[model samples]
Target chain A: MLIVDRVSKKFNVNGKEKIAVDNVSVKIKKGETVCIVGPNGAGKTTTVKICSGFVSPDSGNVYYDSISLLNRKKYLEKISVLFEGIRSINWALTPLENMEYLSGLRGIKKNKKDIEKYIEMFELGDYKNQQCNSLSRGNQQKVAIACCLCLETDAVFMDEPTLGLDMEISHKIIKILKTYAQTNKKIFVITTHDSDFIEEIADKVLIIEKGKIMFEGSCEEFKAVQNTNTFKEAYLKYRGVL
Target chain B: MKRVITVFLNELKYSFIILNRYRINWMFGLSNLFLSVLFLNLGIKSFGNYVTENVLDLKLTQMIIGLFVFIVIAEGLNNIISKITQAKQSGVLEQIIVNPLGSKYIFVIKFFADFVIVFISIAIIIPLTMIITSKIISFNIYKLIILLIPLLFCTLGVGLILGGATLVFKKLQSATHLMQFLILTLMVIPSYPITPYSFLPITVESMAINKVFSSQISLSFGLLAFLYAHSFAYFILGLLVYSKFEDYAKTKGILGHY
Candidate 1:
């Protein structure tokens, strides 16, 4: 379990201090896929980074199974993160090479069989031998996700994992995440705007706006709060589109 | 130790991959090196008599050693800043920093990789250079290498400072370029028999290198002791300052804002 307690982050831009993530807190349990749904600039990524310890929160503590993340080594060992829009793998390295590099950093002696399995499962074919730059955008994403998932951590935090992926690949990823989270009892915390994907995968939903959590509950309660039957309608309500 | 080795070997693999992927870039870079060595060699030979004349208060061999030593030193220093900026813009820096092994390991390993990649050129450039200068470069090769240790450590120390700045400041290319120019200028400055300016970062190391090759008894143990002390000093100072800046960047939430 991962616990975020009163996390807040502010950024200074052109002499103005902008609050990026307000005082927000959440408890994530194993086997639960929590989706933070919001429109752009909703501070979803900032909150995730703070929780993941990539960005330090001003006045909060993140505890990994009751241990403060100030013990970064233990905390990081238990979690893996896939930040949005970053080439998590170097462009010069092939998919498997990137996986090897990341695993080396994570201090994992990755088994060859597990690597081959993930590559095949993610449908990364001969492109695994090619540099990430040569892979299509969708395949690049798959490789990045595959690298993170290969870590076999207790928790995973992903930002916009399916942003550029085709529906087919996106569904494949969703299936993998569901199976992994269910069977392994792994915790997943994701932020995305894909309403249908979230509807299918999210055990709990958080509607974030302007750095504040507007609503937080089970998916059914989120839809009930908006008085909507469809996840898209509830998400549209959160985005102020409906 | 095992983790460091894994990081180092894997990062080294990536450097080879980069060299192969960016053929045109390496082509131009290698050509530039060849041209510079050619011109420097020809220019020195053309001025062999005047240079032997000790017109600049130094021997011709001293100039060659100074230039080559500067080349190696600059490569180590510049590698840090250049890669930081490149990784920042490519968004890889964020991912790298978030890793459990920490950013320090990654950058240091990458630095070793790049240094080795650059040294592959040195293997060719050195002999070609010695041939150009007519091989009057007889001295303690072992001593010369050992003496150059302080220069390497000092360069790494200062490189970390500037590299830390690059992490936060983002557009530090002009600053780094200016730093390179200043470094080259300082290389020659220490050649002047000045006493008071001995305290500058690389000044002592440069003078120590000159001392090692001159084959003279001015062999002050004082300079050698200073070399050891200052090497550790600059390295430690650089590490401390780098960590401070890194922590500040993380707090300000700009660690990823390329």
Candidate 2:
């Protein structure tokens, strides 16, 4: 479980301070899948970064399973993050090589069989020997996901994981994530603007506007309160639109 | 400590993979070695005349050692500056920034990797030049070892500062040009034992060249200590700047912004 307590972040631009994330708070439970939806410049990414320990909050603390995240390696060990358009693996390395390298970093002991298992599971066996840059976008995304899952961390934070993926690949990724969450009891927190994806997989929805939480509830409850037929309607209504 | 070592090893492995993938870099290394050897031959041909004219007190062997130091420092600085710029352009910088590794670890690994590349070049070029110019050049193993300490540290320090600056400015081409200019100036202004003008030139030349091959190791040690202290200070300052601006860089959605 992750608890974010009144986290805020600000940036200075030309000697002026611009607040990105305001004093916002939220709680994510284990075995729960939460998706945060927001418009452009809505600070959803910043919130994800804060929760994942990539960006330090100016005013609040993040807790992982009741442990202070500040200066704590155990909390970090429990979390794995995938930022949008960010390739964490070395481009010169192959998919299998990247996986083995990251697994070594996480101190996971595995031999050739284990590595091949993950490669086959991700349907990346054909491209396992290909350099990362040579792979297609969807295949690269698969490799990135494989790297994260290889860590097998309890909590996963994905920022726009489906960006630029075609419908078929997108559905495949969603299914993989859902299966991972359901089978392993993992906590999945995704920040994306895609309402269809949110409706499909998000058990709970957290809506943010201009850095503050506008609403938080079960997707069903959110739909009921807004009297919407779709997640888009609920989102628009919560933002004070007709 | 084990974690630090782990980070170091990983970085080393990554560096080798990246460097080996680029066939051009190896070509550049070979060309650089050939050029250094050519210069050493030219210096040897003129050495006797220079000593006969009472222009130099040093042997051709010492001149060759000086040339080796120059080649290493030049190649090291150029490789580092260009690599940092390329990393930013190629999105490698973003990948590194998001990792859990600390900034100090990144800086140290980068510095050491560049140092190793330059060292390897020296190892290859120096021996080849000595073999070709066997009659003119002689090896002083102890002096060579002593010379390496300061030269490595000085080049490492300069490389770090330049690499960090390139991250902020993203004007590596101009920065590299300026670095070349500075190195040339440092080499030429030190006059060989000829005149008062030669005094400043000789002093600068001796300082630059002796740091890598002189028998007196203490001066080189002191210079290395100074370089390290300054390099570390700049490294910390650079990290602070990076942390301060990183969020802005991310929000602006410009990973390779100047």
Candidate 3:
């Protein structure tokens, strides 16, 4: 289980203090996929960074399996993160090399068969040996996401994972992630604006705006917010855009 | 312990891939080093026509030794900042900084990997320089290797200091270039038996390297001990400065930005 207890972050811009995450707390049990949906600058990325042990939170602590993440160096071994707009893997290296190096960097020693499983699963067998920079943006994103899952960490945080993916590949990813979450029993936290992704993969949804979470609940409960048949209408209504 | 070893091994593989992929660049750099050494030797030897044969011979030998030390130490001093800047531009700096073994360990592992490459390049360049200059100055292999331990530490220390500064303030090309010029000056300075300039970074090590190659001057135990102590001091200071800068970068959340 992962617990973010009242985490807050503040940034200074041009000598003015701006709150990025405002006392936000969240909990995710093992095998659960939680999606954080928010507009740009809604602090979704900051929240994810704090949970992933990349960025330190100012006011609160994050606990993974009841162990505090604050000042805990080993906590990083248990998590993997794919930040938005960042390839997260070395572009100068091939996908296979990246997988090996990244996993080794994280202290995991997976066999060739286990590593090749993800390579084939992502349909990257053809380009696994090619430099990642030579691949198309969608394929590059696939490699990045595959690198994350191949680590087999206890907690996986992906920010805008499907941003550059085509519809076909996006659906394939959703299927893969859904199955992976179920079988692995790991904490999966994602931040994206893709409604289909949110609807299909998220067991729980967090709608954040202006650094604060406006709503948090199950998929069905979030959809029932406006008595609507579609997740889009319910989300629009809750965001005051209807 | 296993994690450290894994990180080290992977770092070697990663460095190898990069080196292999950019073979042309590596070759070009090696050629550049050779040509620079050749030109430097010829430039200094131009005055050889006026001096006595023995004086010119000694002068040229000292010049070659100083240039060799300069080339070797310069690689260690310049590699860390270049590596960090390249990683930052390529969007992989954040991943490296967040390595589970801690960023410090990862950087050290990378330093060792780069040092291996540097060592190999030097092995190639040393023979090439000797053949081109027709100066077969034999160095004591044992003493040379022993002396390099402190020199490598000094290089790593300075590299870390520059690397930490790069974490917060990116784009340090001009600064690094200036540093290279200063290092060149400090490297070629005449070594006094007891001079205050020995306290400067890379000075004592350069003097010691010159001594290793010069048959006339023998290295003293006190000098070797001082070199180790001084180099380790810089290493420790560099680690502290780097840690502070890393924390500041994490606080500001600019580690991934350009």
Candidate 4:
């Protein structure tokens, strides 16, 4: 289980104090896929950054099981993150080399079988040896996803994982993430605006706006909040559009 | 310890793979280094007979040693800052920062790997320079190595300081270039027994290399120990300052920002 307790962060923009994340808290159980949906500047990315220890919170702590994430080695060992809108992988390296090298950084020795499995799963066998920069954007996204998932950490935080992906690739990734979450008992906290992704993969949904969570519940309950069946309708009704 | 070694080797391998992929960049960088050395030699030769023969020869040797020291120290000091800046702009800095093995150690390993690559380039450049200039420069290989190892340690420490500043400051290219210029200027100052220049970074090492090559003075154990001590001190200081800057970056949530 992962718990984020009363986390808050403030940033200075244009020499003015701006609250990016404010007194937010969340708890996610193992094997659960939780999607955070919000408008622009809703503090979703900041929250993920804080939990991943890339950013420090001003007033809260994150924990895995019963251990505080202040312990960097344990925190890093248990979590992996994919930041939004960036080429996180080394552009100069082939996808296979990146997988091996990144996993090696965590002290995880991937066997040949594991390498082949990821290759087949991501359909990267054809492009595994190509430099990531040479691959198409969707393929590059797949490689980045594979590199992160290959770590197999207990908690995975991904921000906008399907940002530039096409419908076909996005669905494939959604299916892979759904199955991975189901079988591995890992906690996935993703921030996205993709309704299909949320409908297909999220077990629970968090609606955040203006640095505060407006709603938090199962998909069914979230839709029922507006007495609707479709996630789009429910979201629109909640935002006073329907 | 084993994990550290693995990270180091993996980083080294990754660097080599990248270097191989960008062979053109490698070639160009080598050409640049070679041209610098060649021009310096040619320029010195053009100044022949301007001074007494003995004085001219001594000045040439000193200048060559000074230039060589500048190159090595520049590599040691600027490599980390450049790596950090590149990583930051490319969005890979955060990934490395969140490594379970600790990002700082990974960078140090990266520096060591880069140093190895630089050393290889130096090996190639040395002979090429020697061949082209017909300058069979000679030095006590053992003493030179002894002097350089610690000097690299010190330069790397200073590099870490600049690298740490790059982390927080985010735009330090001009500052680093200025620093490189300052180091180049310092390289020209001859060693003195009790001068303030002796205490500046790399000054002693530069003089010591000149001493070994010219056979002017024998290096004592005390002096060698002092070099080691000075280098290690800067290295430790660099690590501490880097950690502090890293903390500030994390607090500011600017690790991924420009």
Task: Give chain B TM-scores in order.
Answer: 0.87, 0.69, 0.93, 0.92
- Chain A only: give the TM-score of model 1: 0.94
State which docking tier applies to candidate 2. acceptable
lDDT of 4 by residue, A91-160 (tens): 7788888889888766677776787688788899999889888998888888888889998889999999
- Please give, for residues B155-219, the per-residue lDDT of candidate 3 as tens digits: 78888888989988887644787887888877766654758888787888888888667766688
The global Cα lDDT (0 to 1) of model 1 is: 0.78
The 0-to-1 C-alpha lDDT of every candidate, in the order given, reads 0.78, 0.68, 0.82, 0.83
Model 1: per-residue lDDT, tens digit, B1-258?
Answer: 787787777777767777888878987877787678778767766776555455432455666667667777788888988887887777667667766777766776777778778778676666666676665666576776777777878887888888888877877766676776878766766533446666677877876676567543354667678777887798788888887878888898788777
Interface RMSD, in order shown: 2.0, 4.4, 2.1, 1.6
Q: TM-score for all predictions? A: 0.92, 0.80, 0.95, 0.95
Best by lDDT: 4
CAPRI docking class of candidate 4 = medium
Ten-residue stretch with the least lDDT total in model 1 chain B = B51-60
lDDT of 3 by residue, A1-242 (tens): 88899999999989999899999998889899999998899999989987876677788989888878864577776788888433577888888888887787776776788889999988999998999889888778878888889988899998989886789888888888898898989889999988889889999999898789888998789888678777788888877898
Give the range of the ten consecutive residues with the poorest summed lDDT in model 2 chain A.
Answer: A101-110
With candidate 1 superimposed using the best TM-score fit, by how many Å does residue A187's alpha carbon deviate from the native? Answer: 2.0
Using DockQ as the measure, the top candidate is 4
Lowest-scoring 10 consecutive residues by lDDT in candidate 3 chain B?
Answer: B185-194
In model 1, where do residues sit more than 4 Å from their true spots?
Answer: A238-240, B51-58, B136-141, B191-194, B214-220
List where candidate 3 sits over 4 angstroms from the true fold: A84-86, B189-194
B121-231 per-residue lDDT for model 2 (tens digits): 677776776666663444467755554554554555556666665655555557477665676565556433334543221223335355335342344555545434543
